[model samples]
Target: MRADARKNHDHLLAVAGTAIAEQGVDVSLRDVARRADVGLATLLRHFPTREALLDALLRTRFDELTARAGELETSSPSEDALVSWLRDCVACAHEYRGVTALMAAALEDAESALHASCVAMRAAGARLLTRAQAAGTARTDIDGTDLFALVAALAWLSDQTSLAPRADHLFDVVAGAILTSAGNSATGTTAPRPRP
Candidate 1:
C-alpha cells in the first residue's frame, strides 16, 4: 500500500471501528464511508463486503489487545496481573461494545475474524491465567476457557446495563464465582453480593 492509500485505509478502519463500536456491526457501510470522508467506492475498494470490514475491524482490535497482554505479561503476583488484565479487557469491552457480537455474526458469513480473534485472545489469556494460578491467586480448577467465557459473559452483561457504577459490581458478582473456596472465604458468604 502506498503512503496515501495506507492513510486512507487506516482512516476507513478507524471510522468503521468507531461506527461499529458505537452503533453496532449492523451500522451500514455508507455511514462508515461518511465518517471516513471517503466515497462508498473507496470503502468497497478496501473492504469488499460487510464481512470483510468487520473482520478487519475485529482483527485490528484483537491484535492490539494481544500486544497489550504480551507487554503486560510479567512475573507479577498472579491475582494482581489477572486483575490488571481483566481491567484492561473491560476497558476494551467498553471501547468496542458489540465486538463480541460482531465477531459472532462474522462467523456466520464464513469470515476469519472468529478464529483469529479467538486464537489471539486465547493465547494472551492463557499466559495471564497461568501466572495467576502459579501465584496461587486464581482457582486452579478454572482454565483459560472458563475465564474467557466468564469475561465474555460479563462483557455482554455489562453492555446490557448502563448503570455506571453498578457495572463494576455486576462484573465482580459474575466473575467472583470462579474464585477458590478459600479465596473469598474472608467475606464469609457464597451468596451473590447484593447489587448497589
Candidate 2:
C-alpha cells in the first residue's frame, strides 16, 4: 500500500476503535467514516465488513492476552494466573456491548471472522486452567469451556443496568466457584438472580 493509503487505513482504525469503545461494536459504520474524515467507500475498502473491522480490533487484544498467559505461566502461581486471566477475559468482552454473545457464537464456528481469535483466547485460558487443576487449586472437573462460559456470563451480567451495584460481589462469588474451597455451598449467599 502507498504511504497515503496506509495513513488513511491507520486513521480509520484509530477512529473506529474509539467509536466502538464509546458506542459499541454495533455503532454505525457511516458514523465511523464521518468521524475518521473518510468516505464510506474508503472504510469499506479498508475493512470490507463490520465483522472484518471487529476482527482487526480484537486481534491485538487476543494476542496480548495470549502473551500474558505465557508470561504468567512462569511468573505467577497457577491459580492466580487462571483467575486473573479469567477476569481479563470478562473485561475484554465487556469492552463492547453485545460482544459476549458474539464470542459465544464465534467459539463454535470455525469459519467466523472471530473464530481464530476466540480460539487463541480459549487456549490461553485453558493453559492457566490446566495448570491450576494440576496444582489442585481449581476443580479438575472444570475445563476451559466452563471457564469461558463463566467469563461470558459475567460479561453479560456487566451489561445489565439492574446489576450495577452488585456486579462486583457477584463476580467474586462466581469467579470463586472455580476454587475447590467454594464447596458448592449456597448458604448465606445473596447473589443476584437472573430476571425472568
Candidate 3:
C-alpha cells in the first residue's frame, strides 16, 4: 500500500474503533466513513466489507491478548495466569459492545474474516486453562471452548444494563467454580485477586 493509502486505512480504522467503542459493532458503515472524512468508496477500497473493517480493527487487540496470555503463562502461577487472562478476555469483549456475539459466531465460522484471530485468542486462553488444570488448580471437566463461552457470557452480562453492576461479582463466582481447592489456595482466595 502507498503511504497515503496506508494513512487513510489507519485513519479509517482509528475512527471505526472509536465509533464501535462508543456505539457498537453494528454502527453503520456510512457513519464510519463520514466520521473519517472519507468517501464510502475510499473506505470500501481499504476494507471491502464491514466484516473486513472489523477484522482489521479488532485483529490487533486479539493478537495482543494472545501475546499477553503467553507472557503470563511463564511469569505468573498457573491459576493466576488463567484468571488474569480470563479477566482480560472479558474486558476486551466488553470494550466494544456487541462484539462478543460476533466473536462467538466467528469462532465457529471458518470463512469469517475474524475466525483466525478469534481462534488464536481462544487457544491462548485454552493453554492457560490447561496449565491450571494440569497443576490441579482448575477444573478438568471444562475445556478451552468452555472457557471461551464463559468469556462471552461474562462480557454479555456487562452489556446488560440490569446486570452490569453484578458482572464483577458473577465473574468471581464463575472463577471460583473453575478453580479447585488447591488452585484457590494458590491464588490466596476462592475468587482470585483482580488483575492490577
lDDT of 3: 0.90
- Model 2's alpha-carbon lDDT is 0.79
Please provide TM-scores, in order, for all candidate models, with all chains considered together: 0.79, 0.86, 0.91
Clashes per model (N, Cα, C within 3 A): 0, 0, 0
lDDT of each: 0.68, 0.79, 0.90
Comparing candidate 1 with candidate 3, which one achieves the higher TM-score?
3
Q: How large an RMSD does model 2 have?
A: 5.3
Query: Which number leads on lDDT?
Result: 3
Better of 1 and 2 by lDDT: 2
Q: How do the residues 17-119 of candidate 1 rate in per-residue lDDT, one tens digit apiece?
A: 7887788767899989988888899999999998788777777677777777776776445555566677667666666777665544443454464576757
Which segments of candidate 2 are over 4 A away from where they belong? 1-3, 182-196
List model 3 lDDT by residue over 1-196, tens digit each.
Answer: 9998888888999999999988999999999999999899988989999999999989999999999999999999999999999999999999988999999899989999889999999999999999998988898888999999999999999999999999988888888888887778544556433322
Clashes of 3: 0
Q: Write model 2 residue lDDT over 52-126, tens digit each, in one string.
A: 888887877777888888888899877677767877788887777777778888888999988988898889899
